[model samples]
Target: MNKTDRLLAIVLELQRKGVLRAEDMAAKFETSTRTIYRDIQALSEAGVPIVGAPGLGYSLMEGYFLPPVSFTAGEAVALMIGTDFVEHKFDSDYRTKAQSAREKIEAILPESVSQETNRVRTTIRLLVTGETYNSGREKEGLEALRRAILDKRKVRFHYSKNIPGADGNRHSVRDVAPYGLVFAQGSWILVAYCDLRQELRHFRLSRMSDLTLLEDSFTFPTDFNLQDHKPADDRRVLVRVQVHPDIADKVKGAGSFFMTQMEDHEEGLMATFHVRQPEELLHWVLGWGADVVVLEPESLRNRVREEAAKMLKGY
Candidate 1:
């Protein structure tokens, strides 16, 4: 980067991290400590509120803040693409907010950069499937749920419960202390302490109705860590599958979420995934049809064989 860009980046880094060591900055910028020092000196000369101590490294002076910085063409394009993804994948309220944010960003950018960003926005497309869009009531409920979670308040909602051999869905009003929200598999799930069940439960946001934010406040448990929490069936089982070469790239791209490891093989790509349930893994493998073959876990293989036979019978 040029000296100007480096100085701006240094300000941004300090603003983000509060303090940073000269050695670390040097390594991050791929430059010598002397160069970093020179850049720091240049920024100081420009009246930037930078302070340094012998052991504490460098920091901006207290209460120092920089004005909004301009984005390069590349940065603008990236932001535009992100907004596009949000618009396509998120709920209507979120999509509307994203569109407003994009407009505000565009208004701040230089004409040339703005035009390029608009071009990129028009060209890029992010498509997703298996998503159920929220109705107006559900959108309002989601907003209320987020507020309840943030405020450490309790919430009440009528949840639809699916029971085996039931005539229809059973509806029950549940009082829950909101904890966290999770977006997974194209659905929003609320993780909360259900007063009705007397335990933590995952409630599908879509299956909830008559949502109401309670005035009763709750104390958030200091010991409760969302990252440490796991379901009863959290034991991971390794599932191996072979994939066709044509779809290998797609399979590998999804490895972060599933298919934890993959390698090339003579037949195709050998992929390994860690899943809590064999049926969950089976469903994913079956989605690829003949392009994928389960290689391990005799139970999963047998299940796939039975499903395939049923499919063939339908044909």
Candidate 2:
């Protein structure tokens, strides 16, 4: 491995093992102990917070955090692409934070790696067209919600439902114990336990206003695992679709989180997805236009036809 790469690997080894001997590092990297000593000296000179004891080898100083480690060209490009997506697609407040982080990554990268990363970044593009998220109007609410989630505090907010019920009151006050924040379907959703509803609910950050972090604190449930928790509307239907060969990869990449199975065919790619709602599948299929065909679940096909007819009528 290159010396620069090896130096970075040594830092990673020290981090993982808390301490590493020069002999062990040499054996792992297939280099001489003399070379390892030189590398250690170089790293210490470069302000890496490395400390050595007489017999204990080398380790990072306690409480010293090495800024993110070096990245390969491909990894750097991927990070830039992902941050760019978040900068465009996420809330404005988060977009600024993501941009700041990307700048830091760029600033710390070695010049050679930075140049190749820039080359790859220029060659790759992620285009987000159409109105995916609300503008930055909900910045305060989102920030408050995040703070509440982090502090394990209850929050009170007035929410204006996109569709009001028969009572015709557009807004209602709710008290919830914020558990997690989820970014999905182009919106920030607060996954919280609603004191009023007496159950967990998802509240769109955009629809929330007049948010206040309550002084009252709550204990998060020990058994509540965010990864395993599903939204209340978690009923799924298996929907199949045929994707045109030209755009199959794009479709799969975008929907990889929800797609269950895919098979390559002569004409195109056949894909099955466990979709929570037909509207979600409808919107996705419509985005592909003629490049995608909904093959099963008559309900989804009919919904697509109905929505397409409405679009045609508008034109």
Candidate 3:
């Protein structure tokens, strides 16, 4: 970067990180420490308030704020698209904020830049299924969970599992300490500390019913960081299926989370899936009817056969 841009970037960095050492700034800007010193001197000469201590690094003076910076046409487009995504995916509160942010961004851009950004953004679109209503149940659940997480409070809900238990029960009540919310695979997932299980658990908001925020509060763990949290992977069973050539593209495009690999074959496409259990794929496999044939895991094939028989009997 040129000296002018690098000097402006240094000011923004100080505003963002509060304090940064000369060595760190030099490394970040890919320049020498001597160059950083000269840049700092140049900024001071330009009347930018930079306070440097012997032991502590350089910091912007308290109450000093950088004026607004101009955005490139590409940057403006990216930010506008982000706002569009937020408005479509988030709840009512965030949707309004996103719209306001978009307006502010557009207002600051030059007319030429704004036109270019608009032209580029028209080619891109965000299509979110099952989020038609702003006040849908899932969005409502997200709003409630967001509040509970911020307040460090407990939440109660009835969750419906995908599979029924031995007693044919598929629903259960849970009391949990809300930690964070994650959006994955077109669904909102809640990460919380389950009071009953005495451990962290993940719950899909779509499967959650009768969610209630409790008055009880809990201390947020200091060590728990949502950015670094990785959910355990438990998919162990491997099931392979052969797809007829006609529907091979459709099968490949299904984007099943359990699907691992797809190999071209003379007969058709061999699609491999890794799941927690064979039953987890039973319905999905049967959905393809005659087009898909289970190649392994006799249990899934048998289950599919039984289900097909049941369908035939109904017919």
Candidate 4:
């Protein structure tokens, strides 16, 4: 392992054990006693509190404490579920990080609850096989962009919109100051300033190519609201529909279409969504077998009727 990896591992290991011997640490790291002492010295200089005697070995200074952190049941479940879900993200390296995180959690958590959690999670597998995940460049760009946002710094990147041309080819490249990265429908979106549009635009991360971070910085608009920029459905097309009483329970929770696939909803559930287009919603409504029907906004019903008639002729 490199210096950073070794350093982080040492801290985690120390955190695992209240105390450790310098000789044992050197043996564990396959390094000499002097090197281990030097490493300990570097860690102390770098903010880790190490205190002890030579014969008694060393210990992270007693009484030193990290901020107390608490997790609610809801939060814990959410984390496990989120991590399980993220396992499918394309060619993602976060799986290793996820494993390390789970280990850390299991290490600190009450044995009984943690064991039960692991029992179920072990049987669950999320595979993103045959999927082209976010390219490494996109991931790096996103990481950099996120760090910049946290630091309130600005970044410049070479961005290009995958806009189709009259001949179905990609349009010219564009420049962007990435603002945020969002995942929708298992696809990532990079929300940024499109210099070509001279305004805000969202680009599909999977389609973005040639990303570069510029040293330029920006201040978010004082009145800026990230939530408002992309509602639960940004390209949402709302349409009223009549669903059967049998499926009414499904409507009780209008799971976010952009965030989730409405896993709890029953079949034939009629719901309104701001999708890319009206036809897409119509197709969904029709797929609910016969229990679903269009109730309001005559325009949508008429379009469905037209499509149905056309389909009937074919049948």
lDDT (Cα atoms) of all candidates against the true structure:
0.83, 0.83, 0.90, 0.63
Best by lDDT: 3
TM-score of each: 0.67, 0.57, 0.93, 0.48
Model 1 TM-score is 0.67
- In the range 123-181, model 4's lDDT, one tens digit per residue, is 76665533444555455455555676666554544444433112334545766666677
**What's the lDDT of the predicted structure labeled candidate 4?**
0.63
Candidate scoring better on lDDT of 2 and 3:
3
Residue-level lDDT of model 1, residues 1-315, one tens digit each, is 988889999999999999899999999989999999999999999999899999989999999999999998889988877887677655677789999999888889999888877777677766665544453444557778888988999999999966522457899999999998776766678889998889888898888988888899998788877778765656388888889999988877765455578789878999888776666676678788889999889888998998899999999
Q: Can you tell me which runs of candidate 1 are displaced by over 4 Å?
A: 21-34, 53-57, 88-96, 128-138, 160-174, 193-202, 220-315
Better TM-score candidate (2, 4): 2
Query: Poorest 10 consecutive residues of model 4 by lDDT?
Result: 258-267
TM-score of 2: 0.57
Q: What is the C-alpha RMSD of each candidate to the true structure, in Å?
A: 5.3, 6.9, 2.1, 13.3
